[model samples]
Target: MNDNDVVRDLTLDGNAVAGLLEEVFGADMTTADGECAHCGSANAVGALRAYTRAPGVVLRCPACGGVIARIVQTPRGTLVDLRGAAHLAMRR
Candidate 1:
């Protein structure tokens, strides 16, 4: 496939994570604040970048291109990884 096709296959907006994050956190997490582990920049989870290619979805820091979260859906279950995020602020 061409580069455009590849990008189209893998690329997505951060808003795509809203539903999954809500399922995980039991609330709307799109407006939640998160800090990038790599650059320390802070922003809303909905403002990050999203990639949905390989076997799962990946959310990246908009500031330094750091991976903020990863979500993989398997036959048995879904796995979520947030190792690249330093901190997340939940609403009160």
Candidate 2:
């Protein structure tokens, strides 16, 4: 599909992922820091523009408008793709 076709489906923000992230990462991940792989924009995951309506959830950078992450659920398991993020800094 075209880029617009994909982006037109975005309907939420990183805040929408708090619960799911807690399940997988064991804590609130929305507040974590993330750097964009495409444009090097560094910001909190909560700051990323999130689209929750689609076959999967898509997160994009607010500064450069590049995709930062994608989360999909399948029959086997939940798949989280982070290739769009160059750095995912979590609190220790």
Candidate 3:
């Protein structure tokens, strides 16, 4: 399948989204203010606002304004990638 097809067909539930957020942020999905394990910054709020607005959307760090992470949900579980943040340069 083409990239467009894959993007159009991806589906995720709330539970999966929550799991992804937890895995990435190490806190509840709705709360904010978690430590960014990468940069050691106190501004890692889980970015729940960004997540809820766009369920599978990844967000950049508001403090550093860098692409520090992503969130994805699948049948297996939620996936978070802190290493994606270009500025942090740290892994979870």
How do the residues 7-80 of candidate 2 rate in per-residue lDDT, one tens digit apiece? 65655678887787778678888889999999897998887888876787788998888888888888899898
Q: Would you list the rank order by lDDT, best first?
A: 1, 2, 3
Per-candidate Cα lDDT values, in order, are 0.85, 0.84, 0.49
Q: Give each model a TM-score.
A: 0.83, 0.82, 0.39
RMSD of each: 2.5, 3.6, 9.0
**Candidate 2, run of 10 with poorest lDDT:** 4-13
Best by lDDT: 1
Query: For model 1, how does the per-residue alpha-carbon lDDT over 6-58 read when each residue is reduced to its tens digit?
Result: 76566676788788778777999888899999999998988888986668889
lDDT of 3 by residue, 40-65 (tens): 55543444224334656655454444
Counting only residues 3 or more apart in sequence or on different chains, how many pairs clash (N, Cα, C under 3 Å) in candidate 1?
0
Candidate 3: worst 10 consecutive residues by lDDT? 83-92
Pairs with steric clashes in candidate 1? none
Model 2, residue pairs in steric clash: none
Q: CA lDDT of 21 in candidate 2?
A: 73
Ordered from best to worst TM-score, the candidate numbers read: 1, 2, 3
